[model samples]
Target chain A: METTTLIPTGPPATRPRRSPARLVRAAAWIALAVLLAALPLYIDTAWLKAGQYMMIGAVGAIGLTLLTGQAGQLSLAHAFFLLVGATAYTVLAGPTDEERVIGLGLDPGLALMGAVLISALVGLAFAPVAGRLRGIYLGVASLSLVFLGLYFGQSLDSLTGGTSTGRTPATFELFGFPFSNGGPEIEVLGVPIRQAERIWYLFLVLTAIAFVLARGAVRGRVGRSWRAVRDNEAAATAMGVGVARAKAGAFAVSSAFAGLAGVMTVLWFDILKPDESEYGTYGINVSIAFLAMVIIGGLGSVPGAVVGALIVNGLPQALTLFSGDLGWFGETGGGGLTPILVSSFIYGAAIVVVVLFEPGGLAAIGRRLTGLFRARPREITREETS
Target chain B: MSAPTLREDLVELQVDSVTLAFGGLRALDDVSFTVEPGTVHALIGPNGAGKSSCFNVISGVYRATSGRVRFGDTELTGQRPHRLAKLGIGRAFQNTALSPHSTVLDNVMLGRHALTTGGFLSCGLRLPWTVRQERRHTERAVEICEFLGLGKVLHAPVAALSYGAAKRTDVARALAIEPTLLLLDEPAAGMNAVETAEMAATIRDLRDALGISILLVEHDMNLVMGIADRVTVLDFGKRIADGTPSEVQADPEVVKAYLGSGSEDA
Candidate 1:
C-alpha cells in the first residue's frame, strides 16, 4: 500500500512567493488611505457631505454585490432593508415627547446596531422564499419588499411618521462623543469641526470597516461557499456546504450591510421619511441604483463595488455640487436634465456598457491592470537572470 | 468528532435493492451492489444505463425511490448530500463542477468547508481562533493540490486549466473533504489516453497512499480494467455483472452488452 513513487514531487511549502508587485499594491493601498483621510482637510462642507452620501452608497453597494454578484442571487430587496434599518433606528432613538408618533428614546449608537439586526431578521424572514427562488424570479420577488416598505411606511404612521412629514432621527453618538455637532467644539488644521466634517470622518470610518470586512469575506471560506453555490449547488452540497444555509446567510449578511447603509442614510439626511410611493427615496429605483453600483463595479468584486458606487452615487452628488459653478442644470422645469436625472442616464448607460463589454465589471479591468503590472516585473527579472 | 482515519478502520458500502424512477422512466431499478473497504470499485455501463443515477443515489444527490444505502452502519437512503459528506462521502461531477473565476486553491479549500466550523462573523472578525483554523485548512488545501500534481497552478483561475487539470481539480476538492468514499464521475470523460493514464495513477494513489475507498464511473474500458480492483457492470439499469476485473471482463452478458450481438438482430 505504501506508494513511495506517487508522493507529491514538488516542494511542500505553501508560502506564496513574495513579489514586487504585491509590495507596490500594499503601498498603493496605504496611499489611497492617506488621501481619503486628508480629504476633509481640503474639501469644503458641501462636498464633504456629498462624499458622505457616496460612502452610504458604497456600503449599500458592497452588500448588494455580496448577494447579486458573489452568491448569484439577484435581489432588489436592498431598499426594503434600508427602510427597515432607517425605521428601526428612528423608532428606537426618536425623542418620546411627541404624542402622534412612537419612540423608545434609546441611544443612537445602539439604535443603529438594532436597525441592522432588525433588517437582517427581515431578510432571514424572506429567506425561505429567497432560498427557493433563483435569478430573475428572485429579483422580481424581492421587488415586493419595496412595495411592502412603501405600504408599511404610509400605514404604520406611528413608527415611520407617515410619508408627508418624516421623523427627525437622534444625533449619532459613540461612547459619550457625538458624531454630530452637539459635542465639544474642536479644530482640525484651522478648520472648524462641524456636523458635515464630523459626518465625513464618521462615514469614512464606517465605509472603511465595511470595505475591509467585505474584502476579508470575499477571500475566505464564506466567499468560497457562495461562489461554489453560484457555480454548482450539487457540487457545493456534496462538499458539505449547505445550499440553503449559504443562500440564507448571504441574504442575512447582505441585509445587515444594507442596514448599516440605512443607519448612515438617516444620519446623513437627519431624518427618516417613509416613501409615499415606490418611486421615492427607499424605493425600487434605490434598489436598482444599488444593483447598478454592484454590476458596474463588477460582480463579486469588493473594491469594484466602491468604484461602482462612486460612479452611480457619487456622480449625482458631484454634479449637484458643481451645478452652482458649472451651471449645467440651468433651468428647473423644461427637461434640462437635473443632476439626479443625468446621473441616472449615466448609470443606465454604464450598466448596458458593462453587460456588453465586460461582464466582470470594473474589477476585471482592475485585475487586467494588475496582471499587466505583474507580468512586466516577471519579464524584467527573467531578462536580468538570463 | 475528529476525522476517522483510514489506517485505523475500514468502512464498506452496501446498496441494497436501490430503485430510483422519474414519472414514466426508471433511472435505476432495484439495483444492488456492495463496495468492500479500501478498494477501487468501478460502476460502468453504456449510455443511459443508470451509471450516474446509481452514483447519485449512493451519494445522496438523488433519493432512492425505494431502497437502502448503507455506508458502514449509517443508512443514507434519503439523506441530503451535505449530511452524506459528514458520513464521509465526497463526489466529483461528470461535468467538472468548478467555480470559473475562483483560483484552484480556493476551489480545493472549499472541500474543507465541512471540516471548518463557525461562520461569517468568525471569519469577518478575523478572530484568532478562526484565522488559525483557516490557516491549517489552507495548508491542507495546498498539500492536496500538490498531491494531485497541480501545485504550480494553485493561484490560477480554474477556467484557465485544461480539461484534464480541471477534472483533477474536482477530485482534489473532494479529497480535501477527507472522505472515506470518493466518488469519481467520469474523471477521464474528456481526456486522451495519456491523461486517462495519469488520472488512473492519481486515483490509485488516493486509495493506496491516502487509504481512500473509490467508486469510479467511467466509459473508458482500458482505464477501468487497469485501475479498478473490482468492477460492477450495469445494463438497462440492472446489475449485469459484478466481481474481480478479469472475471467481469470475461462475463458473457457484459461482452454481449458491450460489442453488441451483431446489432441488427436486437
Candidate 2:
C-alpha cells in the first residue's frame, strides 16, 4: 500500500527567517530596554518611585493576563494570592526575636522564593473548583478568595500584624547586596543611588524577568495547550491536552506571578497592611484593576499585557506626578477629584473606548500595522520560492 | 507514562455490540463493527441516524451504556478522552474545532501534545531539551501541513483561512498525531466538488502511505462509494447493513434508510 508519488512541497523549513520587519522589531525592543535601563540615572527619586509602582503593576498584570487572557480563566483571586505572597515573605524573613509576631528568619532571597511557592500551592489548592467552573462563574467563585484573604489578614495577627498596625517587611537582599540603602554607598552618573533609585533598579530587574519568562511560556507548548483548552475543551481533550491539568497549571503559574507582585507591593509600600474595607489593598478593587489591565491590554498577548499594565497602573501614578506640577486634582479628602479619582475616571473611560473601538487592544493594532508592511512583499516571495 | 511515546501499529478496532443511551433516548443501540488493519471504513447515514454519537463513543467522549470498544488490546470505552490520543486515536471534528486566532501551524502542533513532554516550567524556561523537542515537532507538523496542501498558509491564522482550507487544517492537525487509527467526522461535509474530490484523494493517499486504519463518518455518497473499502449503514441508531460499498448500496434496508420508508420500493 505504499504511494511514492506524493511529496510535500512546503515553503522552506520551519526555522524562523529573519526578515527586515523582524529585525526592526527586535532592534526596537532592545532600544526600549536600553532607554528604560538609563531612566534611573536621569529621573529624580519621586519619578523613579512612580516608575517602580508601574513595574509592580506590570508584574501583576502579566500574571493576570496569562490566567484570564491566555488560559481563558476569569479570576478575581489575584489580590488574595498577592496577600499570600506578601505575608509569606514578611513572616519568613522577619526577625526571629520579635515577641508579638511569628518569624522563620529565613534569608530574604529564599523567603521571596518561598512566598511564590506558597502562593502557587494555594492556587493549586483552588484548582479543583477552578477546573469545574468557567467564565463569569469562575470569576465570582474566585472573588470569594479575596474575602477569605481579608478575613485571614485581620485574624492572623501574628503573621499579618493585624489591621491596626501592619508589620514591616524585611528589606529584600540578594546575597550581601541589599535592595535597601544600607548595603553600599554607590553612585551612577554622579547621582547618589539611594533607596528610591535602588528600589527602581530592583523592580526593573524583576519586571524584566517576569516579562521574558511570560513571553517564553506564551510562545511555547504551555501556550498552545492553554489556547486549545480555551477554544474548545472537547477538541483539546481529543488532542491529548489534559483539560483539568492545563487549567490547574495556568492558575498556579498566574498565582506565582501575582505572588511575586505581592512581594513587590510590600516593598513599594514598606508595609503589609491588609485592607480595612473591601476596597482597600488586597481587596476586590485591586482584583478588578488587574482584570482591567489584562482586558485593556488585549487578552492573551504577552507584550499587550505590559502595555495594558502601563495604561491601567501608569495612569494613576502619572496623574499624581502631573498633579504636583500642573495643579490638576488640587483638592483631596472630600468632595474633590484626587489624582486617584481622576486616573480612575480616565482608565475607566479608556477601557470603554478600548472595548468599543479596539477589542484586541493596542497589541492588535501593532500587529496590523506590521502586517500591513509585511503582507505583500514577504508573502509573495515565500509563495514564489515554494 | 514515560513521555507518551507513539508508534503506528496496524491493529483491528472492535466495537462489540456497543449501546449508548442518554436517558430515554437511545443514541446507539447494539452497534457492532470491526475495522481491520490499514483500511478505510466509512459509517454513513442520514441526519439523526447517530453517526456523530457513534464517533463520540469511539473517541471516548461518551461511554457506552453496554458493550465495549477495543483498540487492539486496550479497552477504549471509559478511557479518559485525552488519553485516547496516546493510544494512537486522532480525531478531526466536523465543524473544524480550532483556535481561530492562532496560526495554522500552532493548531496543528496541538495534535503533538500527547507525544511531547514539559509543562509551564520547562516550556517557560525554554529548557534545552524542550526547545529541541519543539523544533523537531514543529518540522514534523510543518510537513503534515504541507502534505495536506496547507504549506503556504502555515503562519496564517486559522480564522483567516478559507472554509475548505480550514477543514483541511483540521485533517492536518489530526494527521500530526501520527495516529494508527484516524477518525475523520464529515471531512468533506461543507466542501465544494473540487475540494471534496481533493479531500477524497488525500484520504486515500493517507491510508496508502501511512498504512493506518481510517474510520470516517460522512454523508457524501459519491466520495464514500469512491474511496471506502468497507461501508456500514446505520438507521435510527441501528446498523442496517455492513459490506462492500456496492453490496451495501444494493441492500434494501440501506436504500430505505437513505430515502425515507415511503421510497422503500424505489
Candidate 3:
C-alpha cells in the first residue's frame, strides 16, 4: 500500500472551503448511491446477487487497502481472517439445541459483531510476527495463518462443521426484523421484495458503513501516520508515531473488515462449508484475488479499492448469470477456461499494465480527470533562488 | 521554568562515553560529548568520520555497543526515535525523509505527532475532540511553515516542490515537533550561497528567538564558523578538537585533518 496519494492538496484544516470541483465530486457520489438504490427494482435476483457479491468484495478490499495499501504492510492473510470471521459467526449463532456442533446460541446481531471482534483479535495476535517481518517475509508469514485456518477448519468440526457436511448459519436478524423471506412480507412501490432483495439492502448498508469509515481513516491524522510509516519508518518514529503499533493496528482493522465480509459471505451462501482444497474458497488464491483488487484500485485509494473489487469480483458473478444463456463455457471446460480463469487472466493483465504504465493505478487516472475541473490548475511551483 | 546561565541551561544532552562496533570494525570509539542547552554546537569532520554514526546513536536509530545517553535526567540509551521526539529532540535528515506524495503541510503536520495526542479511533471516526486536536496541530504546523517562508506552497505535494523548497519544508517539519534541541545534518549541503545564508539566519533565529539549542553537522566551514558557539571536530570517530569556532578553526590538528592545512593562511 502507498500512503503518498492520501495527502489532501487543499488547505485550511478547520473547514475546507467548498469549491465547484468538490460539489461535482459530491454530486457524482450521490448519483452512484441513487443508482445502487434503484438497481434491485430493474434487475432480477441473479443480477442482484452478482451486485451483492461485488459489494462483499468492496468491503474486504477496503480493509485490505488500509493494511496493504495505506499502512504498507504486505498481507496474504485476508482469507484466513475471513475464515475466522465465518467460523466465529457460525459457532456463536448456531442453535443451542444443535446436536453435532458447538453453539453459543447468541443473538445473530451480536454474533455478527463478535465475528469481527474475534477475527480482529486473531489478527492482532499474529501482529507480533507480522510487525517483526517486512515485505515478502511478512507475506510468507501471513500465508502460514491461512494454512493454520485451513487446519482449524478441517479439525475443529465443532466450530466450522467439518469440510464435507458444513453447517448452515442462523439467519441474521436485527432486533425483531429478520433479514430473510421469513420476516414480515414487504413490497417496494409494487415490486415484490424477497430474501435476495432484503439481503442486498443489508449488504448495502454494511458496504456503505465500511466505505465511509475507511474514507474517514484515509483522510485523518491516523492516515498521516500510516503513510509516514509506509514511506519511511525512521521518519515516522521520529515524528512520534509508534511504527509497530501502527502496523499491528492496520492488520487488526483490516481483519475486522474481512471478518465482516466473512459474515456477509455466510449470509449470502446460506452454508458454511470449509473448502477441502487450498485452491478453493478460503485459500491462498482467494487471498491473491483480494490483493489483486487493492493493486488494481491503486493501493491506498479508498474509492479505487471499491472499483478494483467491482472489476475483479463482479466479472465472475456476471459470467454466472450468463451461464445458462451462454453454452460457450462447455467447449472450453477441457482447456480449463472457466469464468474464474478468464477473470484471473484479465486481472493478471490489469496488474501488469498498472505496474508497467500508471503506477498509481486507476486512482491516478481519476485524480487527473478531476484535476481538469479545478478552478486553478494547481500553481506550477518554481524554485525562485535569490 | 528556571532562568538560563550564560554557559548553561537547565537540561543538557549528555552523550557519555559511547562505542559502536560492527564485528571487528569500530564505528565509534569512546565518543563523549554534550550539547549544552540554548547554544549552537557544531560537530564537523571530513566525510565518513562517524558524524552521521553519532547522529544515529543520539536519535536512537543505532544502538551503541557500550554507552549511556541522557536527555537531562532521563536515560535515553535504548529509547526509540518516537520517544526521543516526545522528549523534545528533533532531527532533520540530510536527504530529507519526507513523504514525497503528500502535501507540504501534511509532511509538516507529521512533525506535530509528538505534541498532539489523537489516536486511531478518534481520528478514524472523525470525532469532534480529534478534529479539534488535529486543527490545533495543523495550526502549529502552519506557523512553522510561515516562519520558514514555506507558506506559499503548503498545498503542493513535496514531489512537485523544488529542492530548496523541499529542504526548507524538512526544516519546518522538524521545527513543527517543537523540540528543545534541533539536530541538523548537512542542512545546507546542496544549497546556493543565498539559500545557505538564509539557512544560517534561520538557525540563528531559532537559537535567539525560540531559544532552541542546535547540534549542527555540516562540512560547510563558513556556515559552521559563522553560526556555532562551540565546535567539536572528529577524526576517525575520535574527538580531535572541542572549543569555540575560532579556537577549533585555528587548531593545527583540526586544519590538518579537515580544512587541509593551509587555505586561510596561504
Candidate 4:
C-alpha cells in the first residue's frame, strides 16, 4: 500500500469587489421608493385604487415567482387558495344568522390564521403528487384544484352562503379601531384621502414584507438548492439535496401567500360569496388572471412579479376607461368589453412576447435599462477626464 | 519490496460475485475485486469491458443483482449515491457533470452541503452562525480550486472552462466532500499529454496531502502504469490479472487483451 496525503493549495485571499453598475442600480431603487412614497398626494383617487390592487396582486405574484421561477413548479390554483382564505374569513368572522346558517363564531385575526393554515394544509396534501409530477403534468394537476375549489364552494351552500350573496359583518376591530367599519380618514399634504387610501397603505405594507422575504429566500442556500434542483435534479440529489421536500416547501409557501391575498381581497370587498355570477366569487376567471400575472412578470424574479402584476392588473382598468370614452365597441355598453376578457387577451399576448423575446421577463428588461444608463455615465466621465 | 507503511489496518473494498442485468442483456457478470485502502488502485479494460459498470456499483449509482459491496464496515451495495457519499465515498463521473450555469465556487459548495447545518430558514435569514459556516466552506472550496490551479476561474461559470479544467473542477467538487475513498472514472479521458501529466501530478498530490484512497478507472495504460500502485486488468467483464503495475503489464493474458493473440509472448 502507498500512503499519500493530498494537501490542497488554497487560493489567495482577496477583497470583495463591488460592481459600479450595482451601486448605480441601488441608487435608482432608492429614488423609485422615495417617489412611490410621495405618490398618494399627487395621484388621483382612481389611480390610487388601481395602485392598491397592484400592491395586493404583487404579494400573490411574489409567491408565484418562488413556485414557478425558483422551484421549477407551475401552479394554476393560486386564486383557489385566495378563495379559501376569503371564504374562511367570511364564514368565521361574520355574525351568526340562523336563517343563513353560515357563521363559525371565530375572531377576525384567528380566522385569518385559520385561512392561511387551511391553505397550507391543502398545499401539503397536494405536494406529494404535485412535486413528483413535472412540466405539463404538474400544470394539469394544479389546474384541477381550481375546479375542485369551485365545486366545494357550490356544493356547500349553507357554508358558502349558496348562490345568493350574503352580507359580511363589520366585526373585525384592531386596537379599538374598527377596520371593517371604515374607521378614520387619511390625508396627505392637505388632500383628504378616502377609505381606498387606508387600504392602499395596508397593501403597501404587506407587499413590502413579501418583497423582503422573497428576496431573502432567493439569495440564500435554499434558493441555491432550488436552482440546483431546477437545473439538474440528479446533480442536486447527488449533493444531498432533498428534491421532494424542497418542492413541497415551495408549494406550501406559495399557498400561504395566496391565502394572505385572499384575506386582503375580502377586507377590500367586505363580503365573500360562492356565486361569482352575482358577486364574482366562484369562477375559473380569477385563477386565469393570477396565472397571467406570474407569466407576464417573469417566472422566478421577485421584482418581475411586482411589475407583471401592475401591468396585468392596471392594463384592463385603463383599457376599460379608454374603451368606454372612445365607444370602440358599442355605445350601449358603458362598462366596455368585460375587464376579464380584455385583461386575459393582453396577458396572453404578454406571455407570448416574454417567452419569445425576453424569457427573463420584465426583470431582464430592467437590468438591461439599468446597465445602459450606468454605462452612459461612465462613458461621459471618461470623456470629460480625458 | 517491503510492504508499504500505510498497509497496516487497511480496509479493502470488496466486490464479491456481483452481477448486473439490464432487461435481457447482462452488463456485468460475477465481477469480484479487492481494493486496498491508502493505495492508488487502477481498473483498466478495453471498450465495453464493464469497467464503468463496476465503478457505478462501488459508488452506489447501480445496485448489483447479486453479491455485496463493502467499503470498510458499511454495506454500500444498495445505498443511494448521496448516502454513500456521506459514508466517506466520493465519485467523479467520466464526463463532467458539473453545473454549467453556476460559478466554480458555487459548484464546489454543492459538495460541502452534507457537512453544513442550518436549514433553509437560517440560510435565508443569513443567521450569524450560518454565515460563518458559508464563509468557511467557501474558503475550503477556494483552496481546492487553487490546489487544482483553478483559482483564476473560481468566479467564472463552469461552462466557460476548458475541457480539462472542467474535468478538474469535477474532481475538486468530489474532493470538497472530504471523502476517505475517492473514485475517479476516466479522469484523463479527454486530456492531452500536458493536461494528463498535470492530472497525474494532482492525483499524486491528492494522495500525498489528503491520505485519501483513490480508485482510478482508465483506458490509457501508460498513465495507469505510471501512477497506479496496483493495477487490476479486466476483459469481457472478468478479471484477467491483478498485481503490481509491472507484474500486470508483464502478464500474458493482460498483454493478449491489449495486443492481439501470440504477440503477448513477445
Scoring each candidate complex against the real one, what DockQ results? 0.48, 0.53, 0.44, 0.33
Which numbered prediction scores highest in TM-score against the true structure? 2
Q: Model 4 in CAPRI terms: which quality?
A: acceptable
lDDT of 2 by residue, A1-386 (tens): 21122234355566567777788989998999899888988988878888888888889999988998889999999999999999999999999999989999999999999999999999999999999999999999999999999999999989999999999999988887888789789987898888888888888888988888898888898999998999999999999999999999999999999999999999999998888888888999999898888778888877888888888788888888888788757577877888889888888987898899999987888888877877574333555555
Rate residue B50 of model 2 by lDDT. Answer: 90
lDDT of each: 0.86, 0.88, 0.85, 0.75
Residue A206 in model 2: lDDT = 87
Residue range A199-269, candidate 4, lDDT tens digits: 66667777877787778777666777777678777666666667787788888878877877887877766
Q: Return the candidate ranking by TM-score, descending.
A: 2, 1, 3, 4
Candidate 3 — which pairs collide? Answer: A1-A68, A1-A69
Error of 1 at A148 (Å): 1.0
* Fnat of candidate 4: 0.32
lDDT of 4 at A350: 90
TM-score of chain A of each: 0.94, 0.95, 0.93, 0.84
Candidate 3 CAPRI-style tier: acceptable
Q: For candidate 1, what is the total of clashing residue pairs? A: 0
After superposing candidate 3, which stretches have Cα over 4 Å from the reference? A1-15, A323-327, A331-337, A379-386, B1-10, B192-194, B259-266
For the second chain of model 3, what is the TM-score against the true structure's chain B?
0.92
